[model samples]
Target: MKKIVIPFTIIALLAACAAQPTAESTESTEPTYEAHKQASWLLGRWENKSDQGNLSEVWEKKNDSIYIGASYFEIGGDTVFSESIELIEKEGVLNYVVTIADAGQGPTAFKLTKSSDSELVFENPKHDFPQKITYNHKGDSVIAVISGKQQGKPHQETFAMKKVN
Candidate 1:
């Protein structure tokens, strides 16, 4: 009877330990949409006019996990460039994807490397040009910067835009 009681007690202890929730399990249960909520401020229309061209970008929240954006550049009332962008959160990872149909290349995806209330940085080191892209949000303006190697030389571009709508 003593042996049987000892075995039963050990089994009960083991079962109790197994039933407890672990730190990793609890962390995995956290809502992924919470991370995406941080980017909600980007939902709007932004425009910039300069000697280079007139640039316009429109961002919209498609759902909890996806944000859609369209960017276009116009010169002399003619659209010279345009691209579609998507910010998607998948399995807790955020990706910035850009597609330019006339570029003759598939969409490029940049992983979110840094983020804050007023800034977001995405990077794709393997890309030929523009390995890093950053967006800094001010009260009613956003400054976007792209930097990388172009033709074996360091290159950077900045677009300072204000919220239009």
Candidate 2:
């Protein structure tokens, strides 16, 4: 009886091991993007210190197709500049819109050029200053990059921002 039991236990353990997935089967499939899924990561406050002032942005979800953000800069105990931003899905594509307080122009729209789990890139070739805007999330920090042609010369600015609770 003991001899039979030992052999049965070994066979059962071998069967279980064989049933486990191999490395190839465990590989993840490519992720599909839903408009709201990517925007949800931005639903928080972010801040950074710069020579221009204390820059901050607050973002919130409005609906499945829209997310709103407000950005401002403070200098010498006063709010010097402000802008309203929005991420909206249009015609099956995502767009980033920026409306400044007194820019004397309509909102500028940047199309979504690239996106991933931790990064988003938008671009607008006709915009006067920034033609490309990118955001990359790494751990607890986000690096925001703005680059384009200024006066026919290339210019770029990077902001290292930390998320606020």
- Which candidate has the top score in TM-score? 1
Model 1: CA > 4 A from native? 1-30
Clashes of 1: 0
Local accuracy of candidate 2 as per-residue lDDT tens digits, 1-165: 999999999999999999999998899954433855875777789999877789888889887678899988899769889999999986568899999998898999999989887999999999988999898987768888999999999999887888996
Clashes within 3 Å, all models in order: 0, 0
Which residue pairs show backbone clashes in model 1?
A: none
lDDT of 1 by residue, 1-165 (tens): 999999999999999999999998777565467557777778899999998789999999998899999999999999999999999999888899999859999999999999999999999999998999999998999999999999999999999999998
Model 2 regions lying over 4 Å from their true place: 1-33, 50-52
Whole-model Cα lDDT per candidate?
0.92, 0.86
TM-score of 1: 0.80
